[model samples]
Target: MTAENVALVIGASGGIGAAVARRLLDDNRYSTVFCVSRAATPPSALAATPGLRWLPCSGSPEDIAAVRGELGDDVGRLARVVICSGILHAGDKGPEKSLEQLDPAWMQAVFHANSITPMLWLQALAKGLGRKQHCVIAALSARVGSIGDNRLGGWYSYRASKAALNMLLQTAAVELARRAPASKLIAFHPGTTDTALSRPFQGNVAAGKLFSPDFVAGRLLAVMDAATADGTLSYLDWDGQAITW
Candidate 1:
């Protein structure tokens, strides 16, 4: 860990988010770890750790300033920023199985969670990144979002929102490359992680397919660390292979 390295993990209350934060802490690669979540209180370990900064607010763009306020001058040291928050279900609604199941409100909420929320975080942290550092900003996207892989033709809202996320990530990468040049913006697929978000759908997952949060976190971070050195944005799986858009 270098004195100047700092890592930011948003949605730090969720399973994957918390696990990634813990992994970063154990890796000792960053002097400060900024954890943001909508939770009223931080996870227990984060609350107890030194050099861990917890910011509580709605995971929205406007609330980013509150986190910025807490981060003070530390934002410039950012080397990695990971967005781990996204929704697959709410109330009785889950991913749509057909066009008839689509609800406008649910679709909107999914879009905001999967795409807009992460973009807002990027907007908040994009400036002041030191030009000399190799910075990577990754958003957890889904392979099911891949248009090339879709064959069954279900989960309309989720598929569309994630596809939208890929577009945004790709476009942002182009601009960041032109400006920051050293920074990499990537859309990362965590697979069917064994989290509350995927719990209901896990019954049908093939053996060895459902992954623990820590496992996914480790793989994703490894990919981010190994690939950002190239300074080109990519949509990659946990194994670091490029995903079709």
Candidate 2:
């Protein structure tokens, strides 16, 4: 990618999102960085970055529209789009109870946060990708999302929603191959990080297994930089090891 390329990162208030923003800024590959989040302000570090612009709003239609307005018509083209927005509502031991105890409201909320939000982003920004060159769109996915890898299944809503996100991304990849011809849509597993979302369950993880946000962000950037337009839907660990399915 050129130095003038622009990258949009959703959920910029979170650990992963903030780290990714800093990494991108440090690389100097992108001329402009849009940090979108529901919070009114970005982290101090991100705010201090020269090229970073905070778009403080939720991932709602109105908020995205405001972002679009700020970007205007002459954005040239977007080189990368990263969706880091997600939620981990199901508790530590996985989904608290069996189907009998599951609530529809909770399930729907999980799906909305994990799956539907990404789809909305794609719908809103697909047309903004630069013409006649490969662009990357990556969404953070989990290995637990892989149906074929589900040997120790639990966390029904979280797992299922992430699986649905994977499916949506796969389908979008195929369609973009035919339509855009120069865009790659990918779903990545960022591994377990030492963030609030993963803290509750870190008890089960071996010592030193939890990654820092900086480490995960760097690896994710490396993967995105190396990805090509060819259909490559990978679910991998932090070390780049492919997860089943």
Candidate 3:
């Protein structure tokens, strides 16, 4: 949209989220940025930005209400919303695992963190997105989430949860097309970034395969900027290559 637009970034305490905020701020395009995270303490960088607002929320209805109270109703009708909230449990990785070794608790944790949390955010904020013009809602998803690309089969819980997230975003896109015809909803795959989430799994990645958070953030911004509210939900890699459903 322009330097005058407002952007809301969820999970702003983390690497990718923080990087995206920085990129948005540096461009001088976004007039204000809302950085939301569950962390009790705000990040130093986010807190230091002049037009940036660090919001603390537990992703509950009550917490979201509190955030809205602090930021006011006008902030809800933002031009762009980026969701970077996600988690991968310790045991959710690895190529081979037997049913006996899988922990139901771990699976539930992964699903809650990776899939359900973002859905709640969408449900809570859908109405706030301005209905008069085009807006963008982009959520961080993963390539492993692609059911059609699961050749090597691994990371059962994480993969399954992301797949669920893709479904949710796609469905949301369809509904938004009718209700808020100007808003585009998308599911994004940031590829193998050099962040805490991907550090343990980078051994097999090529030298340039693991991207910096800033790089991924920039590419994501580019993708979102190019997207139209045509009910075409995308699952794409860092290079903007579309991943199969």
Candidate 4:
């Protein structure tokens, strides 16, 4: 990314998202780093990281549009767009391990957070982001989303929602190819990072297999940096390895 170019990082509140935003700011390559999240303002920690400009957003159409409006003409200078928002659980509800445990309400929440919301951001930003010579829209996805790679079945809603997300991104690549052929769309899995989202599930994750947020963010950036827009969507891991659809 050029010094005059801009970068947008959605869901910059915590975990892997926060790490990526900080990494970008620390890189000092982009002229501006617009960080969006549900918080009323940017976190106190961000003040320590120079070059980060937090733009408060609720992940709504209006908010997304507001963010677009905030960028104004510089929206076209968007070099890299990374959407790191997602939900693994909320309230008392978590992923359903069995079909009987599935609740439509819970499933809907998962889909809304994991899949639909990210699309809304894409929808809002797609037009301005279309002008970049080499832009990449990287959405955080899960390997569990891979229907082909699923040998152990469970986490129905989580799996299905992420699978749906991958499909949406895949379809978006086609549209992006038409509107912005130079841009690339990616469904990126950050691996099992040590975050609240993976806290409960960490028991099964072997030692050294669980990665830190910084590690995952670094790896993801490396992959995105080296990757080219080949007119197709890519489902890849933090290691830059391709995952089956």
Candidate 5:
């Protein structure tokens, strides 16, 4: 929250990601807000925002490194990093309702986007996060990822991918404790937000539960503000409540 600190949001072209980027820039706590996305064009809402630097990245190792190179000294000043890259459905592919609907190709694609992509960004940012400055790294996870709390069993690939993401963050937190003691990692579940990601599935979400992107963004930043760098991965929801893993 320091005036001189910087914040970075990957997958900045998406609904929640764009919201977070806009919120950060509006807060004016950070001197610069760097938004990275695979999209060829920046989100129109953020295109004109001052103190916002949009970086085009493919979420590959090389692209991430190139972004770091582009940032130069700003990487060290990063106080918050949010990875919002994830996939639930695309084109003909949708969440599996049953075992019979599962397809290996679709599953693999979901896993790559939801699990591997975020980890790659985490790996690339690890060194930069090691600086003495306090930093919080948060990735968009889901309540469905919680094995202990799961009562409904469906969405096979999406659920598994988020679960894998949680595990990866947990393991990374342990290593980061030794290397970047000042940083904290978070796995966040944003609930049923009113976004394109949930549009096709919102028919079942109870009234008053479908949050707007702005509300989720505010809640997430508040959670980060109150969080401590305890060298653990906190799985939290939009309300700042802990999620069982």
Candidate 6:
């Protein structure tokens, strides 16, 4: 790994995102690990980590652009960018179980968090990521996003948002293939991790399937390391298995 390479983790206030940032810092691969999240500061556990920089972001266009500007020339040197921004539930609004529960506002919010936000960040980082050095860019996606694998047919907003995210990444991969041939894009599903995002749904997860934040972070890093810069968007699981699109 190049000593000058840097990494960025968006939504680093979350469990998986924080863990990924910590792992990257521990690996000693990146010279700096930028953690962007809605929170102004990191969790107490991560605040003391060296080589870690916390940047507050609200996922807005202005905020995202400002964060990129904060990178300055380091933008071109970014080796890894992991976008963990997504919303499964908010307050009393949870994943819908049926068509009757669908709400336009909720759907809009989910789409913004799961799809548009990532695409916005991708747009902002396109030039910097279009360099010759090998780079791996990953976005946190869910298995429920797969159109072909949908059997239960619930959580309409969440599912559709993630599916839209996959499409955005797929389309972006095609363009980046020409502009950034040395870069690889990945849509990663970390499964049902034991985080606040999954806390309410953990009861239904099968045994041996739910994972810890640290375990998922390690596996994600391993999967990304094994990925080749083929200019294709890989929708993969924690174990590096490709999921049906």
Assess every candidate by TM-score: 0.95, 0.92, 0.92, 0.96, 0.97, 0.98
lDDT for position 116 in model 2 = 95
Best by TM-score: 6
lDDT of each: 0.84, 0.80, 0.81, 0.87, 0.90, 0.92
Return whichever of 2 and 3 wins on lDDT: 3
Question: What tens digits encode model 4's per-residue C-alpha lDDT throughout 22-125?
Answer: 78887767878889889877766566566788888887787778887887877788778899989887778898888899998899989999999999988887
Q: Residue by residue across 35-141, what tens digits does model 3's lDDT show?
A: 89998766676667777877879987788777766766645457778999888745545322556656777888788878988888787777666566577889999
lDDT by residue (24-100, candidate 2, tens digit) is: 88877788888889889888868777888888877778877777778764244678778999988645324534667
Q: Ranking under lDDT, best-scoring first?
A: 6, 5, 4, 1, 3, 2
For model 5, the stretches where C-alpha displacement exceeds 4 angstroms are none
| Highest-scoring model, lDDT | 6
lDDT winner between candidates 1 and 3 = 1
Winner by lDDT between candidate 4 and candidate 3: 4
Query: In candidate 2, residue 50 scores what lDDT?
Result: 86
Error of 5 at 141 (Å): 0.2
lDDT of 2 at 184: 79
Model 3, residue 200: C-alpha shift (Å): 1.5
lDDT of 1 by residue, 57-91 (tens): 79756678778777766777788889999898988
Query: Judged by lDDT against the true structure, how good is candidate 2?
Result: 0.80
Give the CA lDDT, 0 to 100, for residue 107 in model 3. 82
Give every collision pair in model 3.
3-29
